[model samples]
Target: MISRGNRGNALEALVAGLRGTPTDRADWQAVIALANRTLLTPDLFSSLARAGQIHQLPEDVREYLRFVHDCNRER
Candidate 1:
């Protein structure tokens, strides 16, 4: 099983990876969402997504994640 610390480290690494492959907007958006949720800063994901720099997340997984975040925040 993955340790909690490892998961945190992996998410941070993914966030850092964004700076390198910034061309993959979809991936970046997904990564941003993951980072935001994991780090508990949901607005950062939406803010970055709306910024038009990273294209909206296309994958169902990413969309569902955003939906969950939205619903949780609304509650």
Candidate 2:
């Protein structure tokens, strides 16, 4: 199982990658795969969103974040 710190790092890296001038497909894919392997919680989701960088994320990632946020709310 992935550690919380590592998961957070992956999210941060993904955000950073998305915000870069030229996105890297391999890095994005690796981050997305990491995200898939790690369990996301409300607090982590909130932290990622609070970074104010969601606009830089890909549409699919944004949608996934929204879905996770909604799911967190439902809990």
Q: How close is candidate 2 to the true structure, as a TM-score?
A: 0.52
TM-scores for every predicted model:
0.40, 0.52
Stretches > 4 Å off in candidate 1: 3-9, 13-41, 53-56
Q: Estimate, for each residue in 1-75, the C-alpha lDDT of model 1 and write its tens digit.
A: 445665665466455444432234334444554666566435443554555532434466446546756886898
Q: Candidate 2: list runs displaced more than 4 Å.
A: 1-26, 41-44
State how far residue 31 of model 1 sits from its true place (Å). Answer: 6.0
Backbone Cα, N, C clashes tallied per candidate: 0, 0
Worst lDDT 10-window in candidate 2: 18-27
Whole-model lDDT for model 1 versus the true structure? Answer: 0.50
Considering only N, C-alpha and C atoms within 3 Å, which residue pairs clash in candidate 1? none
